[model samples]
Structures are given as structure tokens and as C-alpha cells.
Target: MKTKAVRLYGKSDLRLEEFELPEITDDEMLAKVVSDSLCMSSYKAALQGGDHKRVPDNVAENPVIIGHEFCGEVVKAGKNVAHLAKPGDKFTVQPAMFYKGSLEAPGYSYPFYGGDATYIIIPSEAFETDCFLKYDGEAFYHGSLAEPMSCIAGGAHVNYHTKFGSYVHEMGIKEGGKMALLAGVGPMGLGTIDYALHASRKPALLVVTDIDPVRLARAEALFTIEEAKKQGVELHYVNTAEKDEAYVMELSGGTGYDDVYVMAPVKPVVEMGDNILGMDGCLNFFAGPTNTEFKAEFNFYDVHYAATHVCSNSGGNTQDMREVLKMMGEGRLEPSVMITHVGGLNCVPEVTLKLHDIPGGKKLIYTQIDMPLTAIDDFAELGKTDAMFAELAKIVERSNGLWSAEAERYLLKNAKPIG
Candidate 1:
């Protein structure tokens, strides 16, 4: 059998390549990828290529599958496997897979497995047993968004209650009271918005701040702004880079935000996050700082006196994936509003290299799946335009189609015949 995967040959050297499939042991199951999404961490692994700690140096010789977020359909199961791991069932698999004996892991710990590929060999223990309710990718991406949505869900559950000042039962500190979003734009930021909008009742306002004028324009043009406004909540897009202090003050009515979450990689935003907090505001540093080596200073005087808080989250929890999915199904959230681009698995690596250039709300990497997908046409969106388009010209020039969804389904449906 054959399997095609997106490999990280070297820094900026991610490529979609083909390979032969290994025999599956009786304890293992063979699955074809139905969908996968790009994460910033994907880029990190690619930058270092196979030298990454997750993938062993040996497998690094092969392209380390760059995707950690993905879901797939079981195509084959070993004889020893039970009915529970049967074929045709959908799941958002755990990216890491270890060897039979010693904790000698292969991918991640080595390079035996990773997403951004057409197929994978999954062991029984990598994932939680509760498959049905977990981010039902079928509902969101026709089984496409299993991984991406899961990450959002994962972040939500990563210590959901991180000291939010004081806990008031009714309105104050309530589910839908007041929340702040700093630098809210792009897909990841929008995911945060969607989570805050539908999942958390903490912030009723759901203030989304961004420095990009075009992004702000597109949000309203897209669906979020109007949706947030229609819901009787405030979705304020602020320009922090230019008039940082004034805008923050104006939005809070001089009270400042109650809960602020930063969604971009910018580090200086930390200081601004501290300043924006309303009394006892719980600041969520959602965005990853550019490089771990650098440090940002916080005002000790203000921190102690005001009792402001600052914390962050990594990806999200598996349980949250279920919460996000159920919310989507119940009509409380719509990820379709944020989707702006779609492609097959083959285009993943290339598309990822140039993701910064592609303008618009969200880019959906659709696996060549037979299932239905979600899209928002009339929603204000940033479409991939031709050369004349100024906003996304650079992104257009830089984006690559490494592992495309079409390529994925092709590899899977026509899976390399097992020897």
C-alpha cells in the first residue's frame, strides 16, 4: 500500500511526498485522513524540520508530518482490535503514537506519525474513548474540523476558571457578562471570538480589538460584527497600535475590560493587556509570544494595587471539542462565518508556508472527503484575489499548497493496496 504525507525536509522545506505503507500489526488499526487543519505549532516544527524533539532524528530524515490537528475515518482494523475501533467510524485522533513496549514513542517523541498526511496507523490508547460527542467534525467540516475545532475546545477547557476576580452567581462574573478580546482578527482570533461568543457566558460585550483597519472592516463585512451586534452585545474593533490608551479607555467607559484575551503573537500587547483590565479584570494571554527567549515587563505597582490578572492557554482540551461541537449543533455558534478558504490535503504544506499572505477571516483545509462542508457566502469575507488586490498581495505571493484535501482523499480512497 502507498501513503502520501506532508514532510518537513528542512526549515522552509515542507513538501508533499509519497511513500510505501508498512504492515499493520493485529493490535493496530489503519485509518485514512478525512480532514486536518494547520496550526502555528505546525510552522514551528517545520522551521526546525526533523530536528524537532517530537519527531525522532531518524524519522526526521523523512518529512515529519507537520499537522497536529486532524480527524479521519477508520478504513481497516487489526484482527485483535475490538468492534469499538471498527472501520468507518470518525475520530479526532491523538497525533502521537508510541511503540509497543518501552515509552519509546515513534512520532512526536520520534517521527513515526503525525497529521498532514493521507493515512496513519493509530494505536488504541492515543485518544479518549468518547468519540461521538467530541467536536463532531461531521457537523462542522463534514468531519473536516475535528482537529482545529478540537484545539479551540482544548484551550477552553485548559483551566477554564483561571481566577476571574471574584465569582458572582447571577450577572456579575456570569457566563454572558463582559469579556474582552485583544487583537481579534484572522482565523485563530475568530476561533477565540466564536468560543467566547457561544461557549463562555462571562463576557456579554465580547469586545474584539484589532489594529488592522481592513480586518476590522472585513469582520463587519464578514458575519461576526453584525452577529455580535445583532445579539445586543458589543464587538468593538479597536486600533491599539495607533491610539492604544485612548481606545481601551473609551470602550470600557473608563472602567476597562473585565476579561481580556490576547490572540496575536505580538509581545508588546502584554503591557496593553494589563492597562485594559477593568477592576480585577482577568486577562487571558491567548496568543503565543513571538519567541520564548524574550521578556516583557509588567507594572508591579498597578498589578498589586488593582489586583489585575494575566494568564494564557495552550491549544485547548479534548473535552472542549465536544462542547464546541454541541454548541455548533444547537445553533449557539457558527464556525462557517469565519471560513474564507478551502483546499484539499495536498495543498497543506504549500498553503501553510504562505498563510500569512492569504487575507480573509478563516481558511478551511478541506480533505478530499465525500462529506458536505460549511461556508458563508454573503458574509463579509477576505477572498483570495488576483495581483491587483493590494491587501493580500504579499500573502498570495507567499502561500503554498503542500498537503491538499483533494490529495488526501485521493491517497485514502485509492489507498495503496496492502501487500
Candidate 2:
């Protein structure tokens, strides 16, 4: 089979090319990628190339396809894995398959198994590790989003707290306790808020802070306080640009927060999260810093006296991905809020290389189409000259300006096919 994909040749060297895919062995299956959500980690991999731990050292000679968070349909199921995956089965993969303790993963390490392609061969290691997940969700984008959402879920699950004089640590955020998300108006932060409100372990008070008022407004509009109140959560969105930590502490009744999450890699954001910890407060440094020497100051006095602690997770495990899929299927989690831009396979190389400079949540790509990267908010403006964008603008407008399964279907049916 022939596949079109964006491959990384070296540092910042990405090319979208069409190549013949080797026939899958009996131990492998083939899939047609439908939707892939671009991630910051992919940008890091492109920048570091072979230097990235998950990226192989021979990328300059043997380039690997880019993109990890993807969902697709099975085109052909090999005999060995036919029972597990049949032709036409919709699926998503947990790309962090720590197969046999190797850091090699699908998007970063595999030449024929990444998400930024029209077709891919699923290797045996994916099924062996049980990372090949069958998705029953209606939208392929939902399945693609399950990977990132799982990371948020895993972050919440990894937080730990202690009881007085007890050596044992309790997993998960403090239930019915005050929780704060610092610099939390980004895409991942939005997912974190969605999971926190819908997950079984609910926080009594949730405060999300960001320096950007525009982002804060958008977040508030997406996740309204009235809706949070129905879920028994006292939710507040604050622009930290104008207010300081004292103002946030006041919202928590001056007792400080029980669970504080720092969503930005900025040093002050980390310090802010540390300063507002209550007794047994667990600070989750959720952001992944590019710099190896990234450091932040924390109150050692609080660590010694207040029992404040810290934890973090890079990506979610298979189980966490399963939980996200379950939640998405049950209509309990809406991860579409994380997406702001949409494009096609032709745009993958440019978008993936310049992802850092792009101002948006998630950039979703349909691997079979040929369209330029465009923002959802710009649909109405672009609709003036294009009939497709006009119809899309109307569809998303009916869905409250968010991308929907309807939009996905419309785009796939009407957009130009990839060359």
C-alpha cells in the first residue's frame, strides 16, 4: 500500500512525501488515519530530531513519521490480530507503549506507524502491549483527543496526599477540597478542567487562573460557572495579570488550596502554585519544560512543616486512555474544547514545524484531505469567498462555535482530497 505522511529527516527537517508501505506481516494490521490532533511534544521531537529520546538516532537516514494523537479505521486486519481488530473497526492508540522497557513509541520512533499519514501499519508490539484501543466514539476527533485527555486524567490520578502521621499516601486529588489551576487557560488546562469537573472525585472549589483575559473569557464561555454549580463545583476564572496570589487565596477562604496545578513552565507560575499550598497540598507540575535545567523556587518551610508535595506525568498509560475513551463515549467529557484549528494532510509539515508560534488550542488534521491550516474562529471571515467555509461556519455556529462531528463529516465529504 502507498501512504502520504510527514517524515522528520533531522532537526527542523520535515517533509511531506508519498511512499509505498511494506505489506504488513501476519502479526501486524493496517489502518487508515482519519483525524490527528497536533501536540507540542511533536514540535519538540521535530526540533530535537534524533536527539529526542523517543526519536531514533538514525532519523537522518531513516526518517520517522510525525504525529501521535490520532484515530482511524482499520483497513485490513492481519490474521494473527484479526480477533482483536477487524477490518472497518474504528480505533485510537496509546502512543506511549513502553514495550519491553523501550522508550520507542509510534509517532516518534516508527517510520510507518505515526498519525500524520493516510495509512499506517500497526506493529505487533502495539497489540502486545495492549496499546491498540478500539474506539466506539462517534467522532474520530474524539478518539484522537482521548490520548491528550488521558494525560490530564493521569495527572489527576497521580497526585498524592497524606494523613496525619500516616506513612501511606492517598492517590488522586483531594475530593471535595479546594483546587487551583495556575496559568491554566491553555489547551491542556482546558482538558484538565473538563476532567476535574466530570470525574467522580470532584473538588468542592475550582479556581482557574491565566494571564490572558481573552483566553480566560473563552474558557469561561466554554465552561460556564452555572454549569459547574450544577455539578456542585464553585468555579471561578481569574486573570492573574491584574490579581495576585493574595486575591486567589482569598477565594479559597484564606486556607490555601488542597490541590494546585501549574499548567505553565514559567518559573513564577511554579512558584505561585507552591506558595498557595495548604496542609497536605499536592502541587502537580503538569507542564513539560523543553529546557533540561528548568527550575523553580518552592517554600522548603512548607515542605518541612505543611506537608506540601509535588508530582508530574509525561503521558497517560493504556488504562488512562481507556478511561478517557469510556468517559468520552458516555458523554461525560467534551475534549473538542481543546481544538481551535483544523487542516488537512497537506498542511502537516508546515503546521508541525511552526506549532510553537501558532496561537491556538489543538490543530486537528484530516490525513486524507488537502487544505491549508485554518482557525475555527476565522471560518466566518473566510466564508465570504468560499462556499465550504460558509457552510462550516453555519454548522459550528449552531454548535456554539466549536468543532463537531457534523463539521468533521462535512469537511471530509466536501474538502479537496490529498494529492
Candidate 3:
């Protein structure tokens, strides 16, 4: 089968090219990718190329497709798994296939098995690891976001210890506990907010901190204070650049935070999160830095005296993805809140190259269409010049400016690549 994709060859080398997909064995499956989301990790991988830990040594010879967060429809099923794979079945995958103690994740390590392509073969290991999942969400983008959301879910579900020798452990964020997302309202932090708001173990107070006013405003627009009040969640969006640590501490009524997530990789931010932890507070370092020698200041005093422990999770497992899908299906979680822009397959290469510089949340890509990576807010402006964009603007407006499945369908049906 012929497919188009953005492949990674080496550092600063990403190419959008057409190639013939190798035939899958009886133990494999092929899927037509519908939606893939750009991530900061992909940007790192693009820059690191062959040096990336997950990237294979043969990437120079056999370039790898360059996305991990995506969803697709099953187009072909191998004889070994024909019964489980219906031709038109929609699904998302947990890309972190920890096969036989190996750290080889798809979208970085596997050839012909990543998510950037229009079609990809689900390798035998993926099936054996049960990475593929049935998706019943409203939009394909929801399926695409399942991976990142699953990572947040995994962090939320990490068990905590009060003492080293203690046999008992605490599960999730404490029920009705105070939580703070330091350097929050970024793409992944938004998913954590969604989960914190709607998960069964709800937070009584959620303080979202960010230095950027634009990001804080966007986050407030998505999750309004009024809605938080309705749900009985005392929410505060603070611009930390302007506010002092004392002001932030007062937001939680002086008890400090029960849970603090260091969402940024900056050293000061990480250290700041460390100092704000309450007794038995669990600080989760959520952002994974690309540099191997990346170090941050930590307060060992908190660990010894205050019983505050630190934890970090790289990615979620298959069970985490399943929980995220279940939450989405139940209408309790809206992972699509992570998306701020949409584009077609052709947008992949450009978006991958400029992912970090892009000023917005996650960028959603439709693998079948050929359109520019246009921000949802820009549809109104583009509509003034082009008739097709005008139609898309109406679709977006109908959904209150959020990128919806209906809008996506309209864009795919009418929009064309910018000439």
C-alpha cells in the first residue's frame, strides 16, 4: 500500500515523502490514521533524531514515522487477529509498548509502525502488548488525545507512601484535597485539569499557575470560574510572574498544597513546586526533559521532615489509556480541550519542525486531507478571503469556536491545501 508521511532521518531532518508500505505478516494489522496530535516530545525527537533513546540505530537506513498520539480506522487485519479487527473499526493506541522490558515506543523507535502516516502496520509486539484499543468517542481527535490524557491519568493514579516502610499507600489525588498545577495551563496541564475536575476523586481546590497571561486567559476561557463554582471546585488561575509565593500560598488557605505538579522543565519552576508541598504532599514532575543531564534543585528537608516525596512518570500503560477512553465515553472528560488548531496530513512536517515555537495548545492533524495548519481562531479571518474557509468558519462558529467533529468533517470535505 502507498502512504504519505513525515519521516525522521537524523537531527534536524524531517521529510514528508511518499513510500510503499511493506506488507504485514499474519500477526499484524494496518490502520488508516484519521487524527494525530503534535507534541513537544515529538519536537525533541526531531531535533535529537538518531540520538533519541527510543529511536533505533537503523533510522538512517529506514526512517521512522514521527507521531505517537493518534487514532485511526482498521483497514486490514492479519489472519492471526482477524476476529478482533473489523475492517471499519475505529481505535487509538497506547504508543508506549514496554515490550519485554524494552523502552522502544512507537512514533520514535518503530519503523512503519508510527502514527504520522496515512496508514501504519500494527506490529506483532503492539498486539501482544495489547496497545490497540477500540474507540467510541464522538470525534477522532478524542481518540488521538487519549494517549496524552492517559499519561495524566497515570500520574493521577500513582500510589503514594506516607513512610518508606509503610505497607499501605494512598491512591490518586486525595479526595476533596487542595491541588496545584505549577506552570500549568499548557497542553498537558489542561488534560490534568480536565481529569482533576471530573474524575471520581475530585479536588476541592485547584490552583493553576502560569507566568504567561495569554496562556492563563486561554485556560480561563476554556474552564471558566463560574463552572468551577458550580462543581464546588474552588479554582484560581494565577499569573505567577506577577504574584509572589505568599499570595499563591494564601489561595490554599495557608495549609500548602496537597498535590503539586511541576509541569514545566525549568529548574526554578521545579524547585518552586518542591517548596510549596504540604505535609505528605506528593510532587509529581510531569514534564519529561529531553536532556539526560537535566537537573533541578530539590528540598530533601521536605522529604525527611515534612514527609513530602517526589515522583515522575514517563508515559502511561495500556490500562491508563483504557481509563481515559472510558472517561471520555462517559462524557466526564473532554480531552479535546487540549487541541487549539487543526490541519491536514501535509501540515505534519511543518508542525513537527516548529512544534515548540508554535504559540498554542496541541495541534490536531487530519491524515487524509491536505490543508494548512490553521488555528481555530484564525478560521474567521481566513473566511473573509476564501469561500471554503467561510464555510469552515460557520462550522466552527456553530460549535462555539471549538474544533468539533462536524467542523472537522466540513474542513476535510471542503478545505484544500493553501497554494
Candidate 4:
């Protein structure tokens, strides 16, 4: 069967092309992709291309599909895994697959099976590795977001405890304790905020710091202090560049944060988060750095005397995706807040190329639809000019500028089919 996909050939080379999909064997499964979210990791992959660790060596001659966070419907399942995932099953798979002790993952390593295509082959390894999750959500986009949301959940799951004269480690943040998200108003940071707010063991005081006052202002608007207070959270948004050290110290009641997350990979931000650690404080290096030799300063005195420690999580596993999915299913967490724009598969190349330059949250690509990428906030303005977009704006506006199941239905109902 022929399918359209965005494939990467090498550095700075991404193409939207049509190719024949190979038949699935008994150990594989075929799925029709619905939604895929563009991620920063994909942006980096595009720049690195063949040099990327997970990119297969033959990518230049045989291009590979390039999206990871996605959800789809099972079209055909091989007999080996048909019992686990059958036809018509709506599902999302954890892209962080380590098959047979290899670092290969979907998007970066697989040739025909990635999120940016209309159909994908789920290798037997995916099923054997326990990366597939059955999704019964209101919208397919939510299933795609479960992957990134799970990454945030993974950070919160990292935990540490010290035994008598020894050390111990655990997953998860300090429950119901003080926490700080530094440089935390960006896309991933926003996801962290959503997860932090609705986490089972919520924080008593959640302080979010950003260098940009504008970004901090936007964060305040999204995660309103009133809402946080109602949820038993004392939330604070601070422009760390402007706010003095004394002010932040005062907010933490003289001690420092119990858990400090450095959302940016910058050196200064990492040091800043380290500096504000309270006794037995845990600093989470949540953001990944692209540079091979990225360095940050830490006070060894505090690490030894005050028991300050550090932890880092690259990505979430299958269990983390399951947790985030359940939270979304229960309505305790809303993953849609991360989505700011939506588009069709054809626009994947453009969107992926200028992803960082774009000033919005998650950009969702609908593989089956041929619509241009439209920002949710722009729908209202577009409604004033274009009738069709205006119709879309109404559904989105009714949901308070947030994408909802009704909005998804409306778009699918009105979208022009791929020709």
C-alpha cells in the first residue's frame, strides 16, 4: 500500500513524499495514524539527521519517517500480537523503545514506522518491549500527547531517600512538598506544570521561575494563582532575572525548595536551580542538552553537608504513559493545554523545519486531513475573515480557546480529504 510521510534523508533535509508500505508479517501490525505532535527532540534530529545516535546508518539512501509522539488505529495485526492489539483498536505507543538491548526507537530509527505517516508497521519488538498502550480517550490528539506528558510525569516520579549512613533512590518528586520549576514557562515546562498541579501527591507550594516577564505573565494566565490555591497549591510566578535572590528566598520561607527542576538546558539555569536547594533538596535536571560536553556548577558543600542531590530523566517508559493516560481519562489532567496549533500531514516538513522559530505550544499534525497548520488563538481572528475557519473558531471559542472533542469532531467533519 502507498502512503504519504515526512522522511529525513540527512541534515537539514526533510521531504514529504509518497512511498509504498511493505506488507506486515505475522510478527508485525499495521496502523493508520491519526495525530502526531511535533517535539523539540524531532527538531534536533532534523539538524543532526544521520549523525543522530538513533538514526540508522542507511538513512541517506533509505529515508526514515520522523515523528514520535502520536496515536493511531490498528488496521491489521499480525497473528503473533493480534491478541494484544487487534484491528480497530485505538492506541498510542511509547516511542522510547529499547528492542533487544538496542537504542533504536520509532521516528529516529525506523524506516517505515513513525508518526508522520498515514500508516505504520508496529514491529514485534514494540509489542514484546511493552511499548503499546490501548487508548480510549475523547480525542486521538490526547493519545499523542500522552507520550510527552509522560516525560513530565517521569520527572515528578524521580525520588531519592537516604538510609542510615547510606543512600537510596526512588522515582517521583517529594510528595506534597515545596517545589520549584526554573526557566519553566516553555512548552515542556508547561507540561510539567500541568502534571505537577494534578499529580496524586501534589505540592504545597509550586514556584515557577522564568527569565522572560512576558512568558511568566502567560504562565500566570494559564495556571492562574486562584486555580492553584483552590487545588491546595500556593503557586508563584517570578521573573528570576528581575527578582532578587532575597525575594525568592523569602517565598520559600528562608529554606529553599524541596525539589528544584531546571527546565532549560542552559548552564546558568542549572546552577541557579542548584543554588536554591534546601536541606536534602533534590535538583532535577529535567531538560536535555544537545551539546556533548555541557557543564554546570554545583556546591559540593551542600551536596555533602545538606544532602542536596541531583537526578535526571531522559524519557518516560510504558508505565508512565499509562499513568498520564489514566489521569487524562479521569479528567484530572488536561493534555490539550499543550496544543497551540493544528495542521495536516503535508505541512509536517515546514512545521518541523521552523518549529523553534514558531512562537506557540505543541503543533499537532493530522495525518488524514489536508488542512494548513492553524493556531488555536488565531481561529478567532481567522473567523472574522474566513468563514470555514470562523466555524472552527466558534467550536474552539466555546471551549474557551482550548481544543476539545467537539472541536476535533468539527475539524474532521469539515476537513478536505487528502487528494
What pairs collide in candidate 4?
Answer: 156-173, 157-171, 157-172, 158-172, 383-390
lDDT of 1: 0.56
TM-score list, all predictions: 0.75, 0.99, 0.96, 0.96
TM-score of 4: 0.96
Worst 10 residues of 3 by lDDT: 410-419
Model 3 per-residue lDDT tens digits across residues 111-175: 78787888888888888889888887778888989899989999988836464668577767777
Question: Candidate 2 lDDT, tens digit per residue, 1-419?
Answer: 89999999999999999999999999999999999999999999999998899999999999999999999999998899999978899999999999999999988999899999999999999999999999888899999999999999999999999999899999999999999999898999999999989999999999999988889999999999999999999999988889989999999999999999999899999999998999989999998887878999999999999999999999999999989888988889998899999999999888888998999799999999999999999999999999999999999999999999999999999999997
In candidate 2, clashing pairs total 0
For all the candidates, what are their Cα RMSDs to the real structure?
Answer: 7.4, 0.9, 1.8, 1.5
Candidate of highest TM-score: 2
Model 3's number of clashes is 0
Off by over 4 Å in 1: 50-53, 57-59, 79-81, 94-112, 128-142, 154-176, 224-226, 229-232, 241-243, 367-419
Q: Model 4: how far is 191 from its true place, Å?
A: 1.8
User: What is model 2's C-alpha RMSD?
Assistant: 0.9
Which stretches in model 3 have alpha-carbon errors above 4 Å?
159-165, 417-419
List the candidates ranked by lDDT, beginning with the highest: 2, 4, 3, 1
